[model samples]
Target chain A: MVLSQKLHEAFKGTVERITSHRTVSAFKEKGVLSVTEFIIAGDNLVSKCPTWSWESGEPSKRKPYLPAEKQFLITRNVPCLRRAASVEEEYEAAGGEVLLDNEDNDGWLATHGKPRETKEDEEDNLPSMDSLEIGKKNSIQSIPSYFGGEEDEDIPDMAEYEEPDNLIETDPATLQSTYLVAHEPDDDNILRTRTYDVSITYDKYYQTPRVWLTGYDESRMLLRPELVLEDVSQDHARKTVTIEDHPHLPGKHASVHPCRHGAVMKKIIDVLMSRGVEPEVDKYLFLFLKFVASVIPTIEYDYTMDFDLGSSSR
Target chain B: MADASEKKPILQFAPFQSVVDEGFWHRLSSLKLNKLGIDDSPVPISGFYAPCSHAQVSNHLTLLSESLPTEASEQAACTSSVSLGNRNKCSVPGTIYNTNTLEGYHALDKQSLLKAEAKKIWDDIHSGKALEDSAALSRFLIISFADLKKWNFYYWFAFPALVLEPAATLVGIKPASQWLSPEEAEYLSAACREWRNSNLTADVPFFLVSIASDSSATIRHLKDWEACKGNGHKLLFGFYDPCHLPHNPGWPLRNYLTLIFIKWNIRRIHFLCYRENRGFADMGLSLVGEALISVPEVWKDLNSVPNAVGWEYNMGKKGSKCVNLAKAMDPTKLAIAAA
Candidate 1:
């Protein structure tokens, strides 16, 4: 038994080394991104998605290899309106429709089901509001369904979203500001929900973007690790999502373990290639975020907008 | 007037929960080893908190790596800039009294230290310094003995809140959405959002909300209280509440209440417990309440500092908290554990 265990360990090391090599040089062949590609993808993501900005984090904790000002990509205060289980329940109630490539993974990648209904398909099926009276409510409610269908298309900048009525003229000393008011829900469902500060750091060991989540409860209080786990998909909650010291930030955050990130990403790339869509390294974060969305289905970060070009949605 | 049953309940507040990040401990350990050798002087640190965003969770006064003084001559420079427009992290000035030994920590007069800190807050309120920089009203202190060798830390945090004799009575409290009309809620929400988004007022925890006769609301800094008065508009003393309890405000409000009572001499004050959801003002989570304070004779004296009580509860008990970061922080221990 000991000998078998040793053999298994040695085999695992060999596989890891081989995978690492492939990830290092073959960003096009394999889905994994190199350090430079990660930065390039990050810059593109930040430039495209105003919500996703570069953060230097703590000066001492900043990775020496990475750029000083751009150690990681962070998008703070992303509202998680519902728990993953609730979203899953909604899907199951809607109809137990399976949309992911692999059925064996259970409902892990079931998040794709909603975004799978392409923006064009949604526009074709759902009628636009004929009345401006319902425009604001409809626009806010349909934020999740709104996805950028093309890579080149600009993601709707939620940060800059301002209602004319909500705009206030400030004193000349301060700049004009518009606040996004969290409106009371039309439905009786509790408007209070958790928010997550989602950040992505390039994991050198895994050669993939590592996603970290710092969740706050409806009252803006920090969620403990166990509390954060409730939002994570059951398939990955304990297995992959472990609370670790954030590389840049001061506190421990729930990070999706990147050990199998390369393998899973490679599978996704292969599936994309089979669909005759040539995925590029610059769009790696988009695809990476899509996979991460599978793990955390409720964090409404700015990832849903950019993945429509290279991947086949249901 | 009604009978004795009509008396309103005394207003209580949820105390601030101190959450020291592991990175804070790591930095403290480094500072203890490298810079602060045998010197156990009070090191000025910063604490960060935002208005409560969750309905059931109280936002912690978190100490991060940035909280500590970056340089060796940190003694001269404790008061840091509070103009950081990061809506999520409003800076609270704090000082850490690190003791050389556990005995020294225990023997330290907790009452005197707490009293001295409360005096500073009292002085700030009276001297009008807190009006200019509202973060001064939320000053905090920590007494710690960092066991560098074992990587263990024994610490107790105190957010000194000045008490008001005959504690403020709650007249009525409810969700802002319930209290304000639809138009009023919408207007107030927008006004609050603008205030939070601005670089100058984002970190200012306390402010005045002036609602015009036309249902439009404008948020002004506390320093502009005189300017905001007698404008023939409704006024609310608004603060960034760190508490999520439906009924009570946070610890910051205790001192804030004292400040209000002393500064403005307002007896019945309508206050806004400004909470947010997803970085925007949520009227459902935000609370609008009225606090009626019966000023004590002692408060009449400008030189007097009222008694305070704000020791943070540790593990649901009234005590100090200890952290054992040796497993995670010690390099030798980490290597050995790895081996």
Candidate 2:
């Protein structure tokens, strides 16, 4: 496709290429366009125009002509260093013309292909990379996911998880003082507090919670279904168990809550959400949206995350 | 958001019916179980067994022993139980995998062995190997002794399948709730089709081929089904009416499911109502179609039963009664009713 001068000027100074691959050049004029190499420093980094191409190869079948306009170097936004660079690049590349990682501001829609909204306006639009795309060399992955929004929400309906009352070492005074203690464990707090040492935040779509459930969610890479709170519903007695279909689940059928899965999910969501450990599980949770006949479609997914709540691996 | 109310779940604590171990156990006691087409003796046949061949039968048991798993081998070795006069030779080891009977049946090698046994069995009528001891029994035994042996074997397997997984086990309640197996379903379907075309009912009266214990409950349930014999062939795995209980444990859930199903599925149905009120209450159960409230005496008689009709309210179960099946269905399905 031929790029008009106006388009060229638009990308002139911003585009940067770290590795010289002629194939990745933003503009292809008989496939020989220049590739640019760029590595930006911090959060203040913005997309500038692609002005030059970095050269580094013997052009052949094994080695290709370097594209000057395509090379762009950026920094890591995750917990570690060099890995964050790769994640940010992947997020940007994955978003491409139609940003899958786009944040909601008037529910940002891509017109024709390119992003309609500016990246600056959408604060929740953090370039988050998924777990599968994590390159072997880039192990320093980002823990911060969209679920735990970088910006605060309007009226956070998100339930703030508190350690269950039983897990906490409250003096008798506290117990006597409040009748409405949320989590009162049945057994001693010792083992009660010693959970599986992991937390997970799942978007509405990623539910069947393959962890500790009858089946697996094939779409996700997180195969070992976690016995996190969401897969189980907490009862008034502070005991959390796998909630089953009302007609079948034998003992106590939770079917009365037709949205029992969602409701139970909400309780687990309340916990990891309080802390900002939201992992990006948007793809899994989003599919379930159609089944939720009633929830308004306008509610933009909280960029916070789809499923990110990971924990200190024991 | 339009309203905060949309978030709450519409249904709460859906009505659930639980069959405690005691309830199912006591109820299943009266069921012949064989009525479900389950085999009593699940024999693992292998060798030259005729429908009446003693040598082949003995070889089969020897194989049954030889293939037993280590644990089971020791158990069988200790008891050393014997049958078909080969008791001493029945000490062959066995494994869990030894029971695959299909290979032996299909093997060309065994067909000759079976034909030989069949030939010898056709020659002798009083050899004592003939099961059921009848002249025509050869026809029954000849068709597929292997299948009969296997079915009988499974029928016998039910003894353990019934006991080892006693109704007390959480899974056993399934047999109580759903006594019909896929096999039984096939039998009923075939039987119905066959009867639809023939005059089998007139040749033999539609009296139940059902068997029950001499236990009081079994006798009472058998009598209830017999009274309902009416003018057609109806088979029922009989259990006493709940009212027959000494303490009258309200209405029995199993019989309630059973009686209602029979009325709805089988033609020419007429079941004697034990407790008019309880029966009416059962009619309220959706699994069972509506009871003929058309009979005013049935309703009037129900007046005598305690906690009968309106009893579902005390127990948190939905009125899935045949009369209320509509209420039991999704509103969407109700909108488009079928013919």
Candidate 3:
């Protein structure tokens, strides 16, 4: 298994090098970014999405090629209310419609299968209908229902799991009779879901914008690396997500392996172009976030915005 | 009142889990090497947390690049008072005692250090300074030894929580959505959203919430409690709760509870555990809990500091967490690994 994994890494590395070689200076064609282009795109993202801001990382660790402040783009405390597995289950249960069949060898968009029933409801409620992108409506609709349905049941069970210190002093009889049976029908309970501080840094190796996630548990404790994996979509969990040292930030963070990011971005851009939307290099992060959403669907980071994609078809 | 028939659970708080960023240690290493070669003094550092933003996850007091002093020459200034518009980063004032040697770190009087830290919080609570900035109630301490040669950092964080004598009892606890009427929840959510979005109040970790008979809610600073009490319809002590557990609130509430009981002479209080989802006030994730407290006789003197118990647990023990970042941070290893 280890040998196969090593082979896979080697193959991925070779593929990335070859693809990067082909699209040396091309952002639209190759879907990879130069360090300069990354800074421009980061600036554009920050201006568009106020939540995303440029951060100057450790002074000594700063890449000489990148500007001091533009070492990374960070948006902290992004909530992930549900596991991606739950989204997959719900989508399957709803008889999810495949928006686009995977034509490109990089079939990342195949995971874009979403239930269409909630689209009209979202379209009615959202005032900025023009800003609504094609695939965003479905996943956005899942958030509220996910909160309402799952949150109620999770609380009473959690109530039973209090600090042992609180329980020890109490009489054994009272503990048995009062607390264990006192599972009052807690319908109105807080959804204690995982939170993530998501960041993006330019990867010189793959020539792609790499995404990193630092997740915290309900009690603000750092989630174990394995626990962090539960939030990642099953498709990319083991294959694409790896715990590595964050380029700018301190400590190891779960990063979406950037080896196939360029290929995936290329496929996404082509799909957009076919739909009469001209993708801009500056708007790359937006597209990057949209695709990253498939890998980490439940992390409710602000990625969708009212950027004009120059869609003549619309 | 340990009446077996009517025994209710005593209110307990979940201890804080510290997350020291890689940059924090890296910066500390630089400081140790360049600025203070052998000086072992308590350095004031800033720790950042937001209102619990996720349903299950509590917001950790995260040490970032901005947590440490930037300049080697200048004394580290407390940046907790300066409100950065980012609602996600509410700075809490903290002190870090970095020792020269591992033996020195172990030799340091931990009990007295914790007492000293807790006394600062106690002083702030009594002097009405904590009312101005309740972030003072969440004062934290760190004792660390940076092994610069090995790039190993042995550190432990203590978020000093003043123990309430005759500990607070949980009258009732439930989700804010269930506790408040739809209209009341709506008004409270709107008020909280406004508070979180504002540049000034966004970083204020603690505040007072007054709900009118008409279900109109207003969020005020802790200092405005006197003003709020006069016009109060229904008052709830609101704080940026960092715990999402259904049973208990986070560690910050322990000191806040002490402050409310001792300072305000409040025996009973309805607290709003202000949590958020997607940057908006999430009433479902937020909690409303009623706690009853009796002021300890010792607190009447106002001179004696209460015994605190908030040394952060590492792997379920009262121990320091060590991080070896040599492979990740060393330039030679990085270059070799990259190749």
The model with the greatest TM-score is 3
Ranked by DockQ, the better of candidates 1 and 2 is 1
Residue-level lDDT tens digits of model 2 in B133-213: 221111111111112221211100000000000011011111211333444433433442232223222111111222122
Best by DockQ: 3
The C-alpha TM-scores of every prediction are 0.68, 0.17, 0.69
Q: Residue A282 of candidate 3: its Cα lDDT?
A: 86
Native contacts present in each candidate (fraction): 0.06, 0.00, 0.10
Per-residue error (Å), model 1, residue B199: 2.5
Ranking of all candidate structures by their lDDT, best first: 3, 1, 2
Across A1-314, the per-residue lDDT of candidate 1 in tens digits comes to 43553465468556645553322556756567877888899988865554566766777566666876678987765777666755554554344333334443656655655465464355333322222223343334323211112321222232242223312211121111110113323454333366677899987656788999976554333455556776888788888887666778765578998888888888877877777778877788888888788899877777545445344431
DockQ of each: 0.06, 0.01, 0.09
Model 2 residue B325 distance off true place after TM-score fit, in angstroms: 46
Candidate closer to the true structure by TM-score (higher is better), 1 or 2: 1
lDDT of each: 0.71, 0.21, 0.71
Per-residue lDDT for A37-150 in model 2, tens only? 111110011111111111111111111221221122111000011122333444555565344344333343434223434443342343322322332211111111111223
lDDT at position B118, candidate 3: 95
Candidate 1 B-chain TM-score: 0.94
